[model samples]
Target chain A: MTVQDIGFGTASAQPLPAQKGPVTAARQRRTWTIYAAMCVAGLLPTLLGASASLQAAGIGLWLPGAGFLSVGGWAAVLFPLTLALFVFSLVAWFWAGMVLGPVIVWLGSAALAGAMAGDTVWAGGPYAAAFATAGIGYAFHRRNVRLRDAALAKIAPRVAFLDASLAEVRAQAAEIPDPATREMTPTDLAALRYLLDRALQPVTEWGGFDIIDQFQPAALRYQLNHMGFALGIAQTAYVPNFHGYMGQAQRNLIDKYLLRKVWGYWVYESCWGHLNFTNWDPAARDNIMLTGWFGMHVGQYMLASGDRRYLEPGSLTFRLNAKTAYVHDFNTIIGSVKTNYDSAEFGLFACEPNWIYPICNHYGLASLAVQDAVTGSDNVRRYAPGWFKMLNQEFTDEAGSIIGLRSQHTGMPIPFPTGEVAYAAFQNCFAPGSAQQQWAIARREIAPAIHPDANGKMRISLPGKGLDTGNYKSGHTGSFASILVAAKEFGDAYVAEAAQNSLDSDCGLEIRDGVRRYTGGSNDTNTYAILGQLMQAGDFRRSFTQGPHAPSRTGPVLEAASYPAVLVAQAISDGDNLRLVLYPGAGEGTQTLGLERLQPGRAYTVTGATTDAVTASPDGRAGLDVMLCGRTAVTVTPA
Target chain B: MACCAFAVYLLSQLLWPLRWLRDRLLVAPAVTASASVAWSPASVAAPVARKWRWKPALLLLLAAEVFGLGVAATAASVSAPAQPSVEFLDALHGSICSAVKGSLS
Candidate 1:
């Protein structure tokens, strides 16, 4: 049913208003008079020696800079006119979307000012800047406001219903006593296992493909990181084939984003294409928001598989333009990260063209720790001190929580939610000390709103009243996932279980092809659940507190003639015994398998197959032909 | 000073058609329709019913003033050897003055 069907909007038989009006001489006269008055108001200060400061402050409301005020005499005329042009452009933006309105105002004003410049070099530069700034800023503001308002309006009815229903459920739930807490049971482990297995199954690709039109590949990068996290942790957990598959997957993701002469489009067509502002990148490329996320995924893979192939020199090359490529080994990438810390007066890297997003940066810092964990790199140890110092100085609010989306140019926090509920667990990965501090504040401030129902399922509410439709999910599934992650990391099993219970109750799930997929939630939210489940007390702590762990043997437990070809369902070896499960991803043909890493000097018999005997070569390799079918298991025992 | 101001005034007048078109396309229809609904004849008198007689006269005078300003600015700028010629302003004044003078003649 439509929103209007539920009585959300007025349903009228009245047709939409007519789209034209009659023009009259009087109207034309009025328009001219107003136009002339604006022109005169704008021109008086420019043509005559007048108080340009007064004109700027009186009409523009605020002077842009002392430099603008420094332009004395006729040169100062552009200030008030810039202000007038800005006001006009705001009205124009109610009509035009994107950068068109601002471009028009900037160019038009500059062109007009050029007439007055004579031979002056910088006559129209300030005017052009002022007009563009005002127009573009106003347009961006309008767009954000419209989005916020529309979101609030669209979700109001549903949120209201949810609030009232959830309130009643919460009230009923409160009567029941808090359930006894315990460690993760076998049942819980099974559920977690099932979720992890589901994550492994090939699914629809995540991440936005809009890099050229509007550079927001964040969704894709986020999903890739979480996917890496889920699979990376699964290596140590239950998934047998995860170690090999995850190693390959991590390599593929790293290779895909590493700006080589691959992937149909030029690197410039993607988010990474616009990397270095000082280099061949566009003016919008200097943001540090993406490096952290990419680093996190790469780091997770390296940590899990202990493969340092990515770190070796001549690993990845960044294509700047034709014949100009910057080769980046892991050290160079990590070194570039150091530059962000060194250069940042505020110790924060920008996520957007101009705005520094704390959450995205947290991912970055965590990635640095991850790098330190995998490679014997001390970049994090070197840069993190200054980072934390700058972060506290500039990004932290009065309550000690880092500000979300602060402008790097202005150093002012954008009014986006940077609450602990959204970021605490994520920060826990890179900076456990600061994360714990934030969590302490969050637990005190946010713990009260987490009300348990009769089933001990918690319903979390944001601090303020009214559906913060701007971010509706944060108080619900997002909160549950974040809390669960934090609780798991901090050894708060009770809260973690409660949060998990809430997630299970609220976010419905479905089993497809024996893979559990969240039916009611977003990919990111479900991925967050995976991350929360993957959290171990000393997972990231060992990386940050201590240093890089020694690399583990990341090769597959078993290899077939088809190297990296057949998708192995599972493979494990215990001393002299070997077990391997294979799944032919989308085929039914018989295939020969070669044992690359199985124990050497062993004789084995298939339990069900009519094979005389299969012996491992002295080099610990064996070959066997098996039918590629459902649940094919082969056991090898030393004789 | 008056010359530049007048040139800007002429520019605005010449650009009026574009402005009118923008208003018609983007702003005026919705505004006029809302006004019509809010002040329906049943609830309020028609605003256009009592027309002001001086509208035509005011429009004519304004056009003349704008034309004069554009001509004077064009003359002064052309006479000054030190002042650089702006192609945009020159084109604007040439086109607007020609169009207005032809209409008047």
Candidate 2:
């Protein structure tokens, strides 16, 4: 069978094939069912009217103080307040994947009910038990922290001595590949298919996205941003001049980001976390999580495609409602990052209220770098030194690893999984020296984990049962994907290959209808895996710092082509001539191809098509009909 | 017993608005107040009055409370129990008492 017959040539217009196994969905359904059962069990005592204290305790299990609904007095008002608290706790749990939220709500409400009913046995007993459990949990957590710190201390000196030069890294990244001949491998095409399947769908439709949680990393917003990042890299490295489907995919992600379901959580976060109830504008204040990542996404699109549409005033407007909209474009979004950076004492602003994460700040800094590249501004030079200074001083641990998180209000550090590996690729955009140093340390640490799999293929086997933060499940897809990204950025082929292998063999790699995704991972990790696959050496840094190759700007481009029928694997131009490597996406047949940006009124020789020659229209456009059998190659040059 | 239960229920409803006023008037000032000895009664009272305009808010709070209590009383009278469900009322009373106790503790 031909490669096209094995689902490699599926069209972008068709809906993504149904997922083979909805594991996360099944798990979620089971969890919700258990929670519902618990609530139902809690209802029995209340319905029986066994005793006031018993009923109160029961109500606490369902919705705290719901018994007040039966009190038949002004006290009934308290029921709504308690119910609101319960709902807020659920939101918090989903928002951050913090199990403690629901636990606290359940136990605290139960204790409160008992106290209100003057039943020491029910309320006081559970409250004390909760405290004891917490105390034990805290003790175990501290012990783990101590062990982790001691281990890091041993590696501190080695990391400190690792040599990395910013100039060398920059010089290496400055070498751009030729735009005349660029093609994607079959693996790259499969990964691209995964992105297209989601991006080609309606912006409102969320068919392929992970909806396991709405928290920072696991949220749908993150999936959209990461998908955009992957597509941006693809556009820069492979098809620099082709802006057909890839451009649409990137724009759809940006447009989907403007949805309220994606970003409205910031409103609640603003009210309770920041104590600011007057305005709920997401981009107005200190949500670098949204503003920073989104800036890079939108800026990279403009830089790569030379599509300045998003740069238009109010072009990237986020409408909260019919009347209230935070109207912003590329400039204003980057402006928010600058404003926050200038004022922030920590040099890195907060993501969720009171929590400042250096990993997120890496995105914030990279966004500035991309903005500088796009607008010819000196944002990185102006702000990065101070930013790095604060980061080193306040946010670095004894081992020189960037601390995962710190409280913006209090100076307390919180342990998170954002180690050097997670920060390396993003940090490489602006601070290559520090990024390389991080990768060096991370490589040394991760080396021991890379061993031959059952089939003797090198694969990463991370220690312990790693957590996929996207779904709050026990999996290492995210960890493996992260290492793959870092390895690709630092030009460590061995580690990158091993990480990819691990994702392929262990992470349930599924390719259906030409789209490849690691089904074991969430939408976020799968996107990262795709990004790692798309990058060649310095692609990440170059996409942010220098953008697409210069010839891609004023070159002949393959503009119009039907999907599934004509899969343009490689479309590049060196100013005058257009070269395209096409595959029969649907089957072997004759297909029409539209070309644009040619020299007006120039006669061009076109090979591997039905017609041998064609003349450019006055508008610098031409059409060619090509016989697409297996791997059809087409080239149009001035005769 | 019924009268006492009714009184406790009324007091429980009052607690929420009282807590709101305490947060705005009492807790906010203490949190924001400077440790200077040159504090004046008029200076403090003027800002408090100007910033919150508590008079209208208090009036609104009281209005809502009255309206809620009327609705609650009407609902209770209409759904009056044959056996005089004083056990539920007593439980609610105990809840208010326990809340007060817990706060004080």
Residue A211: error of model 2 in Å? 2.3
lDDT of 1 by residue, A181-206 (tens): 11232233333433333233333321
Whose lDDT is greatest here? 2
Off by over 4 Å in 1: A1-214, A239-242, A259-278, A281-285, A318-326, A454-456, A461-479, A534-556, A559-595, A602-615, A623-639, B1-105
Taken over the whole model, the C-alpha lDDT of each candidate is: 0.48, 0.70
For each candidate, what TM-score against the reference? 0.55, 0.70
The positional error of residue A121 in candidate 1, measured at the CA in angstroms, is 27
> Could you tell me the fnat of model 2?
0.00
Looking at model 2, how many pairs of residues clash? 2
Looking at candidate 2 chain A, the ten consecutive residues that score lowest on lDDT are A3-12
